[model samples]
Target: MADITAAMVKDLREKSGAGMMDCKKALNETAGDMDAAMDWLRTKGLAAAAKKSSRTAAEGLVGVAVSGTKGAAVEVNSETDFVAKNDQFQQFVRDVTQVALDGAGDVDAIKAATLPNGKTAEDTLTTNVATIGENQSIRRVKRLEVSQGAVVAYVHNQQSAGLGKIGVLVALESAASNDALQALGKQLAMHIAAAFPMALNEEDLDADLIERERAIAAEKAGESGKPADIVAKMVDGAIAKYRKEHALVSQLFVMDGKTKISDVVAKAGKDAGAEIKLVDYVRFQLGEGIEKEASDFAAEVAAASGVPQQPAPVN
Candidate 1:
Protein backbone atom coordinates (compact mmCIF):
# COMPACT_ATOMS: atom_id res chain seq x y z
CA MET A 1 0.00 0.00 0.00
CA ALA A 2 1.25 3.50 -0.82
CA ASP A 3 1.84 5.73 2.18
CA ILE A 4 -0.21 8.95 2.28
CA THR A 5 1.95 11.99 2.94
CA ALA A 6 0.80 15.03 4.92
CA ALA A 7 1.40 17.31 1.94
CA MET A 8 -0.83 15.11 -0.24
CA VAL A 9 -3.55 15.22 2.40
CA LYS A 10 -3.31 19.01 2.65
CA ASP A 11 -3.41 19.41 -1.11
CA LEU A 12 -6.53 17.23 -1.37
CA ARG A 13 -8.14 19.09 1.50
CA GLU A 14 -7.56 22.42 -0.24
CA LYS A 15 -8.85 21.14 -3.57
CA SER A 16 -11.95 19.37 -2.22
CA GLY A 17 -12.75 21.52 0.83
CA ALA A 18 -13.09 18.31 2.82
CA GLY A 19 -11.83 17.71 6.33
CA MET A 20 -8.15 16.91 6.72
CA MET A 21 -8.75 13.40 8.07
CA ASP A 22 -11.26 12.72 5.33
CA CYS A 23 -8.72 13.66 2.69
CA LYS A 24 -6.06 11.48 4.32
CA LYS A 25 -8.43 8.56 4.43
CA ALA A 26 -9.39 9.04 0.81
CA LEU A 27 -5.75 9.18 -0.18
CA ASN A 28 -5.05 5.99 1.67
CA GLU A 29 -8.06 4.26 0.14
CA THR A 30 -6.93 5.32 -3.30
CA ALA A 31 -3.30 4.28 -2.75
CA GLY A 32 -2.10 7.87 -2.52
CA ASP A 33 -3.40 8.82 -5.94
CA MET A 34 -4.55 12.45 -6.00
CA ASP A 35 -7.14 12.13 -8.72
CA ALA A 36 -8.61 8.92 -7.33
CA ALA A 37 -8.66 10.42 -3.83
CA MET A 38 -10.61 13.40 -5.14
CA ASP A 39 -13.07 11.08 -6.82
CA TRP A 40 -13.41 9.06 -3.63
CA LEU A 41 -14.23 12.17 -1.59
CA ARG A 42 -16.80 13.27 -4.20
CA THR A 43 -18.46 9.84 -4.26
CA LYS A 44 -18.86 10.04 -0.49
CA GLY A 45 -20.30 13.54 -0.73
CA LEU A 46 -17.43 14.87 1.36
CA ALA A 47 -15.92 17.01 -1.36
CA ALA A 48 -17.06 19.78 -3.69
CA ALA A 49 -17.46 19.03 -7.39
CA ALA A 50 -14.43 17.65 -9.24
CA LYS A 51 -14.19 20.73 -11.42
CA LYS A 52 -13.32 22.65 -8.27
CA SER A 53 -9.92 21.04 -8.37
CA SER A 54 -9.33 22.20 -11.95
CA ARG A 55 -10.59 25.75 -11.42
CA THR A 56 -8.14 28.41 -12.62
CA ALA A 57 -8.39 30.44 -9.44
CA ALA A 58 -5.64 32.75 -10.69
CA GLU A 59 -5.82 36.48 -11.31
CA GLY A 60 -5.32 38.27 -14.60
CA LEU A 61 -7.03 40.40 -17.20
CA VAL A 62 -9.64 39.53 -19.81
CA GLY A 63 -8.64 41.46 -22.87
CA VAL A 64 -10.77 42.32 -25.89
CA ALA A 65 -10.02 43.57 -29.39
CA VAL A 66 -12.26 44.40 -32.32
CA SER A 67 -11.39 44.98 -35.98
CA GLY A 68 -14.32 46.24 -38.00
CA THR A 69 -16.95 43.45 -38.04
CA LYS A 70 -14.80 40.89 -36.24
CA GLY A 71 -13.95 40.92 -32.53
CA ALA A 72 -11.95 38.68 -30.20
CA ALA A 73 -11.77 38.20 -26.45
CA VAL A 74 -9.02 36.43 -24.54
CA GLU A 75 -8.35 35.65 -20.91
CA VAL A 76 -4.71 35.82 -19.92
CA ASN A 77 -4.24 34.60 -16.36
CA SER A 78 -1.39 35.36 -13.98
CA GLU A 79 -0.43 34.02 -10.57
CA THR A 80 -1.57 37.23 -8.87
CA ASP A 81 -3.67 40.30 -9.58
CA PHE A 82 -0.56 42.41 -8.99
CA VAL A 83 0.98 40.85 -12.06
CA ALA A 84 -2.11 41.85 -14.05
CA LYS A 85 -1.29 45.49 -13.34
CA ASN A 86 2.19 45.10 -14.80
CA ASP A 87 2.54 47.03 -18.06
CA GLN A 88 4.39 44.13 -19.65
CA PHE A 89 1.63 41.69 -18.72
CA GLN A 90 -1.07 44.02 -19.99
CA GLN A 91 0.73 44.52 -23.28
CA PHE A 92 1.10 40.79 -23.75
CA VAL A 93 -2.63 40.27 -23.16
CA ARG A 94 -3.53 43.05 -25.62
CA ASP A 95 -1.20 41.71 -28.29
CA VAL A 96 -2.45 38.14 -27.86
CA THR A 97 -6.05 39.26 -28.08
CA GLN A 98 -5.33 41.04 -31.35
CA VAL A 99 -3.53 37.96 -32.60
CA ALA A 100 -6.62 35.91 -31.72
CA LEU A 101 -8.77 38.23 -33.87
CA ASP A 102 -7.03 36.95 -37.00
CA GLY A 103 -6.50 33.35 -35.97
CA ALA A 104 -9.19 30.82 -35.27
CA GLY A 105 -10.52 31.10 -31.72
CA ASP A 106 -8.38 28.14 -30.69
CA VAL A 107 -5.89 28.71 -27.89
CA ASP A 108 -3.23 26.56 -29.58
CA ALA A 109 -3.54 28.46 -32.84
CA ILE A 110 -3.45 31.83 -31.12
CA LYS A 111 -0.43 30.80 -29.10
CA ALA A 112 1.36 29.71 -32.25
CA ALA A 113 0.66 32.95 -34.12
CA THR A 114 3.48 35.46 -34.66
CA LEU A 115 3.66 38.55 -32.48
CA PRO A 116 4.87 41.96 -33.67
CA ASN A 117 8.19 41.34 -31.89
CA GLY A 118 8.92 38.42 -34.26
CA LYS A 119 8.24 35.73 -31.64
CA THR A 120 5.50 33.13 -31.35
CA ALA A 121 2.85 34.08 -28.82
CA GLU A 122 3.64 30.99 -26.78
CA ASP A 123 7.31 31.84 -26.75
CA THR A 124 6.57 35.44 -25.84
CA LEU A 125 4.36 34.27 -22.99
CA THR A 126 7.18 32.06 -21.75
CA THR A 127 9.57 35.01 -21.89
CA ASN A 128 7.06 37.17 -20.02
CA VAL A 129 6.65 34.55 -17.30
CA ALA A 130 10.42 34.42 -16.84
CA THR A 131 10.77 38.21 -16.86
CA ILE A 132 7.59 39.10 -14.92
CA GLY A 133 8.51 36.65 -12.10
CA GLU A 134 5.06 35.11 -12.06
CA ASN A 135 3.56 32.11 -13.84
CA GLN A 136 1.09 33.18 -16.51
CA SER A 137 -1.02 31.53 -19.17
CA ILE A 138 -3.35 32.23 -22.02
CA ARG A 139 -6.45 30.53 -20.70
CA ARG A 140 -9.08 31.01 -23.42
CA VAL A 141 -9.87 32.83 -26.65
CA LYS A 142 -13.14 33.52 -28.38
CA ARG A 143 -14.00 35.32 -31.62
CA LEU A 144 -17.22 36.69 -33.00
CA GLU A 145 -17.88 38.01 -36.48
CA VAL A 146 -20.84 39.19 -38.50
CA SER A 147 -21.13 39.02 -42.25
CA GLN A 148 -22.97 42.33 -41.97
CA GLY A 149 -24.04 44.78 -39.27
CA ALA A 150 -21.72 45.03 -36.26
CA VAL A 151 -19.91 42.96 -33.67
CA VAL A 152 -19.49 45.11 -30.56
CA ALA A 153 -17.23 44.64 -27.55
CA TYR A 154 -17.48 45.97 -24.00
CA VAL A 155 -15.26 45.69 -20.95
CA HIS A 156 -16.73 45.92 -17.44
CA ASN A 157 -14.79 47.55 -14.61
CA GLN A 158 -11.95 48.05 -17.03
CA GLN A 159 -8.50 48.27 -15.55
CA SER A 160 -7.09 49.36 -18.90
CA ALA A 161 -8.45 50.54 -22.24
CA GLY A 162 -9.63 47.14 -23.51
CA LEU A 163 -8.87 44.91 -20.55
CA GLY A 164 -11.06 44.21 -17.55
CA LYS A 165 -12.62 41.69 -15.20
CA ILE A 166 -15.48 40.99 -17.54
CA GLY A 167 -15.28 41.10 -21.35
CA VAL A 168 -18.28 40.71 -23.60
CA LEU A 169 -18.93 40.51 -27.32
CA VAL A 170 -22.31 40.83 -29.00
CA ALA A 171 -22.72 39.79 -32.62
CA LEU A 172 -25.56 41.57 -34.40
CA GLU A 173 -26.30 40.30 -37.91
CA SER A 174 -28.35 42.68 -39.96
CA ALA A 175 -28.25 45.15 -42.83
CA ALA A 176 -28.74 48.02 -40.37
CA SER A 177 -26.51 51.09 -40.39
CA ASN A 178 -23.27 50.66 -38.46
CA ASP A 179 -24.20 53.54 -36.12
CA ALA A 180 -27.55 51.97 -35.21
CA LEU A 181 -26.16 48.42 -35.05
CA GLN A 182 -23.23 49.47 -32.89
CA ALA A 183 -25.47 51.34 -30.46
CA LEU A 184 -27.80 48.36 -30.06
CA GLY A 185 -24.88 45.94 -29.87
CA LYS A 186 -23.19 47.86 -27.06
CA GLN A 187 -26.41 47.86 -25.04
CA LEU A 188 -26.78 44.16 -25.65
CA ALA A 189 -23.18 43.54 -24.61
CA MET A 190 -23.79 45.48 -21.41
CA HIS A 191 -26.90 43.41 -20.80
CA ILE A 192 -24.88 40.24 -21.35
CA ALA A 193 -22.40 41.37 -18.74
CA ALA A 194 -25.11 42.22 -16.19
CA ALA A 195 -27.49 39.34 -16.87
CA PHE A 196 -24.92 36.54 -17.53
CA PRO A 197 -27.23 34.61 -19.79
CA MET A 198 -26.37 30.96 -20.34
CA ALA A 199 -27.51 30.79 -23.95
CA LEU A 200 -29.19 32.69 -26.75
CA ASN A 201 -32.37 30.61 -26.33
CA GLU A 202 -33.77 27.78 -24.26
CA GLU A 203 -32.86 25.24 -26.92
CA ASP A 204 -29.25 26.30 -26.74
CA LEU A 205 -28.85 25.69 -23.01
CA ASP A 206 -26.83 22.67 -21.91
CA ALA A 207 -28.84 19.48 -21.76
CA ASP A 208 -27.07 18.35 -18.60
CA LEU A 209 -27.89 21.62 -16.83
CA ILE A 210 -31.54 21.32 -17.81
CA GLU A 211 -31.63 17.75 -16.58
CA ARG A 212 -30.02 18.69 -13.30
CA GLU A 213 -32.59 21.45 -12.78
CA ARG A 214 -35.38 19.07 -13.65
CA ALA A 215 -34.14 16.52 -11.12
CA ILE A 216 -33.97 19.18 -8.41
CA ALA A 217 -37.47 20.43 -9.27
CA ALA A 218 -38.85 16.90 -9.32
CA GLU A 219 -37.36 16.13 -5.96
CA LYS A 220 -38.84 19.30 -4.45
CA ALA A 221 -42.21 18.65 -6.02
CA GLY A 222 -42.26 15.06 -4.81
CA GLU A 223 -41.87 16.25 -1.22
CA SER A 224 -45.03 18.36 -1.44
CA GLY A 225 -47.27 15.24 -1.13
CA LYS A 226 -49.46 16.38 -4.02
CA PRO A 227 -50.97 14.19 -6.74
CA ALA A 228 -48.51 12.91 -9.32
CA ASP A 229 -50.18 14.94 -12.07
CA ILE A 230 -49.95 18.08 -9.95
CA VAL A 231 -46.33 17.31 -9.08
CA ALA A 232 -45.54 16.86 -12.79
CA LYS A 233 -47.11 20.20 -13.57
CA MET A 234 -45.13 21.80 -10.75
CA VAL A 235 -41.89 20.45 -12.12
CA ASP A 236 -42.74 21.65 -15.61
CA GLY A 237 -43.55 25.12 -14.29
CA ALA A 238 -40.24 25.22 -12.43
CA ILE A 239 -38.29 24.20 -15.56
CA ALA A 240 -40.11 26.79 -17.69
CA LYS A 241 -39.23 29.49 -15.19
CA TYR A 242 -35.62 28.30 -15.11
CA ARG A 243 -35.41 28.30 -18.90
CA LYS A 244 -36.76 31.84 -19.21
CA GLU A 245 -34.48 33.16 -16.50
CA HIS A 246 -31.37 31.65 -18.06
CA ALA A 247 -32.02 32.22 -21.77
CA LEU A 248 -30.64 35.50 -23.16
CA VAL A 249 -33.58 36.49 -25.33
CA SER A 250 -36.15 35.61 -22.66
CA GLN A 251 -34.35 37.36 -19.79
CA LEU A 252 -35.61 40.82 -18.82
CA PHE A 253 -33.38 43.65 -20.05
CA VAL A 254 -31.15 44.93 -17.29
CA MET A 255 -31.79 48.57 -18.21
CA ASP A 256 -35.56 48.49 -17.71
CA GLY A 257 -35.79 45.26 -15.69
CA LYS A 258 -39.24 44.78 -17.27
CA THR A 259 -38.86 44.53 -21.02
CA LYS A 260 -37.68 41.19 -22.42
CA ILE A 261 -34.42 41.25 -24.40
CA SER A 262 -36.07 39.91 -27.56
CA ASP A 263 -38.62 42.69 -27.39
CA VAL A 264 -35.92 45.26 -26.74
CA VAL A 265 -34.03 44.21 -29.88
CA ALA A 266 -37.26 44.25 -31.87
CA LYS A 267 -38.09 47.75 -30.69
CA ALA A 268 -34.55 48.96 -31.39
CA GLY A 269 -34.69 47.50 -34.88
CA LYS A 270 -38.07 49.06 -35.60
CA ASP A 271 -36.86 52.48 -34.45
CA ALA A 272 -33.73 52.06 -36.62
CA GLY A 273 -35.81 50.99 -39.61
CA ALA A 274 -33.95 47.70 -39.95
CA GLU A 275 -34.40 44.14 -38.78
CA ILE A 276 -31.74 43.32 -36.18
CA LYS A 277 -30.85 39.81 -35.08
CA LEU A 278 -28.71 39.06 -32.07
CA VAL A 279 -26.89 36.08 -33.48
CA ASP A 280 -24.57 35.30 -30.56
CA TYR A 281 -22.76 36.69 -27.54
CA VAL A 282 -19.84 35.83 -25.31
CA ARG A 283 -19.21 36.90 -21.70
CA PHE A 284 -16.00 36.08 -19.86
CA GLN A 285 -16.04 36.88 -16.14
CA LEU A 286 -12.55 36.70 -14.68
CA GLY A 287 -11.98 33.77 -12.34
CA GLU A 288 -15.57 32.65 -12.75
CA GLY A 289 -16.26 28.93 -12.02
CA ILE A 290 -12.84 28.83 -10.40
CA GLU A 291 -13.01 27.91 -6.74
CA LYS A 292 -10.47 29.71 -4.62
CA GLU A 293 -9.16 28.04 -1.50
CA ALA A 294 -11.19 29.03 1.55
CA SER A 295 -9.16 30.88 4.17
CA ASP A 296 -10.20 29.65 7.58
CA PHE A 297 -7.70 30.91 10.13
CA ALA A 298 -9.33 29.09 13.03
CA ALA A 299 -9.48 25.85 11.08
CA GLU A 300 -5.85 26.22 10.07
CA VAL A 301 -4.79 26.77 13.68
CA ALA A 302 -6.84 23.82 14.83
CA ALA A 303 -5.37 21.59 12.11
CA ALA A 304 -1.83 22.68 12.89
CA SER A 305 -2.36 22.03 16.59
CA GLY A 306 -3.89 18.60 15.83
CA VAL A 307 -7.23 19.61 17.33
CA PRO A 308 -10.61 18.83 15.80
CA GLN A 309 -12.13 21.80 14.01
CA GLN A 310 -15.73 22.57 14.85
CA PRO A 311 -18.26 23.77 12.34
CA ALA A 312 -19.32 27.38 12.57
CA PRO A 313 -22.62 28.00 14.34
CA VAL A 314 -25.68 28.78 12.26
CA ASN A 315 -26.61 32.43 12.34
Candidate 2:
Protein backbone atom coordinates (compact mmCIF):
# COMPACT_ATOMS: atom_id res chain seq x y z
CA MET A 1 0.00 0.00 0.00
CA ALA A 2 1.27 3.50 -0.86
CA ASP A 3 1.93 5.65 2.17
CA ILE A 4 -0.24 8.76 2.63
CA THR A 5 1.74 11.95 3.25
CA ALA A 6 0.64 15.29 4.77
CA ALA A 7 1.11 16.95 1.36
CA MET A 8 -1.16 14.35 -0.20
CA VAL A 9 -3.75 14.85 2.54
CA LYS A 10 -3.71 18.64 2.11
CA ASP A 11 -3.94 18.40 -1.65
CA LEU A 12 -6.88 16.00 -1.43
CA ARG A 13 -8.59 18.23 1.11
CA GLU A 14 -8.30 21.25 -1.22
CA LYS A 15 -9.56 19.24 -4.19
CA SER A 16 -12.41 17.43 -2.46
CA GLY A 17 -13.46 20.07 0.13
CA ALA A 18 -13.68 17.22 2.59
CA GLY A 19 -12.25 17.06 6.10
CA MET A 20 -8.52 16.39 6.42
CA MET A 21 -9.13 12.96 7.89
CA ASP A 22 -11.66 12.14 5.19
CA CYS A 23 -9.21 13.15 2.46
CA LYS A 24 -6.48 11.05 3.99
CA LYS A 25 -8.86 8.11 4.30
CA ALA A 26 -9.94 8.55 0.66
CA LEU A 27 -6.27 8.57 -0.41
CA ASN A 28 -5.61 5.44 1.59
CA GLU A 29 -8.73 3.75 0.23
CA THR A 30 -7.48 4.40 -3.32
CA ALA A 31 -3.89 3.43 -2.44
CA GLY A 32 -2.63 7.04 -2.78
CA ASP A 33 -3.91 7.36 -6.37
CA MET A 34 -5.07 11.01 -6.64
CA ASP A 35 -7.58 10.52 -9.46
CA ALA A 36 -9.06 7.42 -7.87
CA ALA A 37 -9.08 9.16 -4.52
CA MET A 38 -10.98 12.11 -5.98
CA ASP A 39 -13.57 9.73 -7.40
CA TRP A 40 -13.78 8.01 -4.03
CA LEU A 41 -14.45 11.33 -2.35
CA ARG A 42 -17.11 12.26 -4.89
CA THR A 43 -18.78 8.88 -4.50
CA LYS A 44 -18.99 9.73 -0.81
CA GLY A 45 -20.28 13.25 -1.61
CA LEU A 46 -17.26 15.00 -0.10
CA ALA A 47 -16.47 16.98 -3.27
CA ALA A 48 -18.30 19.88 -4.85
CA ALA A 49 -21.18 18.62 -6.99
CA ALA A 50 -20.89 21.29 -9.70
CA LYS A 51 -17.82 22.25 -11.74
CA LYS A 52 -18.18 25.91 -10.87
CA SER A 53 -15.68 28.39 -12.33
CA SER A 54 -15.89 30.75 -9.40
CA ARG A 55 -17.59 31.13 -6.02
CA THR A 56 -18.87 34.66 -6.51
CA ALA A 57 -22.57 35.00 -5.72
CA ALA A 58 -24.60 36.29 -8.66
CA GLU A 59 -28.07 36.60 -10.21
CA GLY A 60 -30.10 33.74 -11.65
CA LEU A 61 -33.57 32.33 -12.29
CA VAL A 62 -35.77 30.10 -10.23
CA GLY A 63 -37.68 27.64 -12.41
CA VAL A 64 -40.85 25.78 -11.48
CA ALA A 65 -42.55 22.83 -13.18
CA VAL A 66 -45.63 20.79 -12.33
CA SER A 67 -47.37 17.61 -13.44
CA GLY A 68 -50.56 16.50 -11.69
CA THR A 69 -49.69 15.54 -8.09
CA LYS A 70 -45.98 16.37 -8.38
CA GLY A 71 -44.07 19.61 -8.81
CA ALA A 72 -40.43 20.68 -8.89
CA ALA A 73 -38.62 23.97 -8.33
CA VAL A 74 -34.95 24.69 -9.13
CA GLU A 75 -32.61 27.65 -8.88
CA VAL A 76 -29.87 27.96 -11.51
CA ASN A 77 -27.58 30.90 -10.81
CA SER A 78 -25.34 32.82 -13.19
CA GLU A 79 -22.89 35.72 -13.09
CA THR A 80 -25.56 38.23 -14.18
CA ASP A 81 -29.23 38.78 -14.90
CA PHE A 82 -28.20 39.06 -18.55
CA VAL A 83 -27.04 35.46 -18.51
CA ALA A 84 -30.17 34.54 -16.58
CA LYS A 85 -32.27 35.91 -19.44
CA ASN A 86 -30.26 34.04 -22.07
CA ASP A 87 -32.28 31.55 -24.09
CA GLN A 88 -29.77 28.81 -23.44
CA PHE A 89 -29.73 29.52 -19.69
CA GLN A 90 -33.51 29.53 -19.48
CA GLN A 91 -33.73 26.28 -21.44
CA PHE A 92 -31.17 24.73 -19.13
CA VAL A 93 -33.22 25.76 -16.11
CA ARG A 94 -36.35 24.27 -17.69
CA ASP A 95 -34.56 21.05 -18.46
CA VAL A 96 -33.19 20.77 -14.92
CA THR A 97 -36.61 21.52 -13.45
CA GLN A 98 -38.11 18.70 -15.48
CA VAL A 99 -35.31 16.43 -14.35
CA ALA A 100 -36.09 17.31 -10.72
CA LEU A 101 -39.77 16.57 -11.29
CA ASP A 102 -38.78 13.23 -12.73
CA GLY A 103 -37.33 12.39 -9.27
CA ALA A 104 -33.83 13.89 -9.28
CA GLY A 105 -34.81 15.00 -5.73
CA ASP A 106 -31.77 17.21 -4.93
CA VAL A 107 -29.03 19.34 -6.44
CA ASP A 108 -26.40 16.60 -6.48
CA ALA A 109 -28.77 14.10 -8.00
CA ILE A 110 -30.01 16.53 -10.64
CA LYS A 111 -26.45 17.51 -11.60
CA ALA A 112 -25.61 13.84 -12.16
CA ALA A 113 -28.82 13.15 -14.10
CA THR A 114 -28.63 13.15 -17.91
CA LEU A 115 -30.16 15.89 -20.01
CA PRO A 116 -31.81 15.41 -23.44
CA ASN A 117 -28.58 16.58 -25.12
CA GLY A 118 -26.99 13.32 -23.93
CA LYS A 119 -24.71 15.10 -21.45
CA THR A 120 -24.94 15.07 -17.68
CA ALA A 121 -26.63 18.15 -16.20
CA GLU A 122 -23.36 19.31 -14.63
CA ASP A 123 -21.53 18.92 -17.93
CA THR A 124 -24.23 20.93 -19.68
CA LEU A 125 -23.82 23.69 -17.09
CA THR A 126 -20.03 23.70 -17.56
CA THR A 127 -20.49 23.95 -21.31
CA ASN A 128 -22.95 26.82 -20.86
CA VAL A 129 -20.49 28.69 -18.66
CA ALA A 130 -17.73 28.35 -21.23
CA THR A 131 -19.94 29.20 -24.24
CA ILE A 132 -21.82 32.05 -22.56
CA GLY A 133 -18.59 33.41 -20.99
CA GLU A 134 -20.19 33.40 -17.53
CA ASN A 135 -19.92 31.02 -14.61
CA GLN A 136 -23.11 29.17 -13.57
CA SER A 137 -24.24 26.42 -11.28
CA ILE A 138 -27.36 24.52 -10.34
CA ARG A 139 -27.85 26.11 -6.95
CA ARG A 140 -30.69 24.05 -5.57
CA VAL A 141 -33.76 21.88 -6.30
CA LYS A 142 -36.87 20.82 -4.42
CA ARG A 143 -39.65 18.42 -5.38
CA LEU A 144 -43.08 18.00 -3.82
CA GLU A 145 -45.61 15.22 -4.27
CA VAL A 146 -49.06 14.43 -2.90
CA SER A 147 -50.66 11.04 -2.50
CA GLN A 148 -54.18 11.81 -3.74
CA GLY A 149 -54.36 15.52 -4.39
CA ALA A 150 -52.60 18.20 -6.38
CA VAL A 151 -49.27 19.96 -6.23
CA VAL A 152 -49.51 23.53 -7.54
CA ALA A 153 -46.68 25.80 -8.70
CA TYR A 154 -46.41 29.60 -8.88
CA VAL A 155 -43.60 31.81 -10.18
CA HIS A 156 -43.13 35.38 -9.01
CA ASN A 157 -41.29 38.12 -10.92
CA GLN A 158 -41.12 35.90 -13.95
CA GLN A 159 -38.27 36.09 -16.43
CA SER A 160 -39.96 33.64 -18.79
CA ALA A 161 -42.91 31.24 -18.82
CA GLY A 162 -41.64 29.07 -15.96
CA LEU A 163 -38.53 30.93 -14.80
CA GLY A 164 -38.69 33.58 -12.12
CA LYS A 165 -37.15 35.23 -9.05
CA ILE A 166 -39.30 33.21 -6.70
CA GLY A 167 -40.72 29.72 -7.30
CA VAL A 168 -43.22 28.03 -4.97
CA LEU A 169 -44.69 24.53 -4.88
CA VAL A 170 -47.62 23.73 -2.63
CA ALA A 171 -48.73 20.19 -1.88
CA LEU A 172 -52.34 19.62 -0.86
CA GLU A 173 -53.46 16.12 0.11
CA SER A 174 -57.10 15.19 -0.13
CA ALA A 175 -59.60 12.88 -1.81
CA ALA A 176 -61.43 15.83 -3.37
CA SER A 177 -61.77 16.27 -7.11
CA ASN A 178 -58.56 17.28 -8.87
CA ASP A 179 -60.15 20.53 -10.01
CA ALA A 180 -60.99 21.59 -6.49
CA LEU A 181 -57.53 20.60 -5.26
CA GLN A 182 -55.87 22.54 -8.06
CA ALA A 183 -57.81 25.71 -7.27
CA LEU A 184 -57.05 25.51 -3.57
CA GLY A 185 -53.41 24.65 -4.15
CA LYS A 186 -52.91 27.63 -6.46
CA GLN A 187 -54.37 30.05 -3.95
CA LEU A 188 -52.27 28.59 -1.16
CA ALA A 189 -49.16 28.72 -3.33
CA MET A 190 -49.78 32.39 -4.02
CA HIS A 191 -50.21 33.03 -0.35
CA ILE A 192 -46.98 31.16 0.39
CA ALA A 193 -45.10 33.22 -2.16
CA ALA A 194 -46.35 36.41 -0.52
CA ALA A 195 -46.30 35.57 3.18
CA PHE A 196 -42.95 33.70 3.14
CA PRO A 197 -43.66 31.51 6.11
CA MET A 198 -40.52 30.09 7.68
CA ALA A 199 -42.01 26.63 8.09
CA LEU A 200 -45.13 24.56 7.52
CA ASN A 201 -46.14 24.57 11.20
CA GLU A 202 -45.01 25.79 14.60
CA GLU A 203 -43.52 22.39 15.35
CA ASP A 204 -41.63 22.46 12.08
CA LEU A 205 -39.88 25.78 12.75
CA ASP A 206 -36.13 25.62 13.29
CA ALA A 207 -35.13 25.42 16.91
CA ASP A 208 -32.17 27.77 16.43
CA LEU A 209 -34.36 30.35 14.72
CA ILE A 210 -36.94 30.09 17.46
CA GLU A 211 -34.27 30.58 20.09
CA ARG A 212 -32.89 33.59 18.25
CA GLU A 213 -36.33 35.14 18.14
CA ARG A 214 -36.77 34.39 21.84
CA ALA A 215 -33.52 36.16 22.65
CA ILE A 216 -34.59 39.27 20.78
CA ALA A 217 -37.98 39.21 22.45
CA ALA A 218 -36.42 38.82 25.88
CA GLU A 219 -34.11 41.77 25.32
CA LYS A 220 -37.05 43.93 24.28
CA ALA A 221 -39.16 42.76 27.18
CA GLY A 222 -36.34 43.39 29.63
CA GLU A 223 -36.41 47.03 28.59
CA SER A 224 -40.01 47.25 29.90
CA GLY A 225 -38.64 46.96 33.51
CA LYS A 226 -41.24 44.40 34.56
CA PRO A 227 -40.90 41.85 37.36
CA ALA A 228 -39.08 38.58 36.61
CA ASP A 229 -42.29 36.53 36.37
CA ILE A 230 -44.01 39.12 34.20
CA VAL A 231 -40.99 39.36 31.90
CA ALA A 232 -40.92 35.57 31.58
CA LYS A 233 -44.62 35.53 30.70
CA MET A 234 -44.07 38.33 28.18
CA VAL A 235 -41.30 36.35 26.50
CA ASP A 236 -43.52 33.29 26.28
CA GLY A 237 -46.28 35.38 24.72
CA ALA A 238 -43.88 36.87 22.25
CA ILE A 239 -42.59 33.43 21.25
CA ALA A 240 -46.15 32.14 20.79
CA LYS A 241 -46.97 35.07 18.54
CA TYR A 242 -43.77 34.58 16.57
CA ARG A 243 -44.53 30.92 16.02
CA LYS A 244 -48.05 31.72 14.80
CA GLU A 245 -46.98 34.56 12.53
CA HIS A 246 -44.15 32.57 10.92
CA ALA A 247 -45.95 29.26 10.38
CA LEU A 248 -47.84 28.62 7.15
CA VAL A 249 -51.03 27.19 8.67
CA SER A 250 -51.26 29.78 11.39
CA GLN A 251 -50.49 32.78 9.17
CA LEU A 252 -53.46 34.82 8.04
CA PHE A 253 -54.22 34.24 4.37
CA VAL A 254 -52.90 37.10 2.25
CA MET A 255 -56.15 37.42 0.23
CA ASP A 256 -58.46 38.18 3.19
CA GLY A 257 -55.69 39.30 5.59
CA LYS A 258 -57.80 38.13 8.53
CA THR A 259 -58.70 34.48 8.19
CA LYS A 260 -55.90 32.09 9.11
CA ILE A 261 -54.52 29.82 6.39
CA SER A 262 -55.76 26.85 8.40
CA ASP A 263 -59.26 28.32 8.35
CA VAL A 264 -59.03 29.05 4.62
CA VAL A 265 -58.08 25.45 3.92
CA ALA A 266 -60.88 24.18 6.16
CA LYS A 267 -63.48 26.40 4.43
CA ALA A 268 -62.22 25.24 1.04
CA GLY A 269 -62.49 21.64 2.23
CA LYS A 270 -66.05 22.27 3.30
CA ASP A 271 -66.88 23.71 -0.07
CA ALA A 272 -65.38 20.69 -1.79
CA GLY A 273 -66.89 18.16 0.62
CA ALA A 274 -63.59 16.51 1.58
CA GLU A 275 -60.86 16.80 4.18
CA ILE A 276 -57.85 18.70 2.84
CA LYS A 277 -54.39 18.87 4.35
CA LEU A 278 -51.72 21.37 3.40
CA VAL A 279 -48.88 18.92 3.57
CA ASP A 280 -45.64 20.68 2.53
CA TYR A 281 -44.18 23.42 0.38
CA VAL A 282 -40.93 24.55 -1.23
CA ARG A 283 -40.08 28.22 -1.89
CA PHE A 284 -36.93 29.25 -3.77
CA GLN A 285 -36.12 32.93 -3.77
CA LEU A 286 -33.23 33.70 -6.14
CA GLY A 287 -29.89 34.65 -4.53
CA GLU A 288 -31.44 34.85 -1.07
CA GLY A 289 -28.71 33.14 0.95
CA ILE A 290 -25.75 33.64 -1.36
CA GLU A 291 -22.75 35.66 -0.21
CA LYS A 292 -22.24 38.32 -2.87
CA GLU A 293 -18.92 39.83 -3.80
CA ALA A 294 -18.88 43.65 -3.77
CA SER A 295 -17.56 43.74 -7.32
CA ASP A 296 -20.37 41.49 -8.49
CA PHE A 297 -22.86 43.65 -6.60
CA ALA A 298 -21.52 46.81 -8.23
CA ALA A 299 -21.83 45.26 -11.66
CA GLU A 300 -25.38 44.06 -10.90
CA VAL A 301 -26.36 47.56 -9.78
CA ALA A 302 -24.98 49.03 -12.99
CA ALA A 303 -26.85 46.48 -15.09
CA ALA A 304 -30.14 46.80 -13.23
CA SER A 305 -30.32 50.59 -12.88
CA GLY A 306 -28.63 51.41 -16.21
CA VAL A 307 -26.21 53.57 -14.27
CA PRO A 308 -22.48 53.19 -13.75
CA GLN A 309 -21.47 50.90 -10.90
CA GLN A 310 -22.87 52.08 -7.56
CA PRO A 311 -23.38 50.53 -4.17
CA ALA A 312 -25.74 47.57 -3.84
CA PRO A 313 -29.44 48.05 -3.21
CA VAL A 314 -30.22 48.88 0.42
CA ASN A 315 -32.85 46.20 0.59
Query: Which candidate's TM-score is highest?
Result: 1
lDDT of 1 by residue, 58-83 (tens): 68999998877899999988878899
Name the lDDT of candidate 2. Answer: 0.86
Give the least accurate 10-residue stretch of model 2, judged by summed lDDT.
48-57
| Candidate models: Cα lDDT each | 0.87, 0.86
lDDT of 2 by residue, 131-216 (tens): 99998989888889988888988898888898998899999999998999889988998998888888999999999878766766
Clashes of each: 0, 0
- C-alpha RMSD between model 1 and the true structure: 7.4
Q: After best superposition, candidate 1 residue 76: deviation in angstroms?
A: 0.8
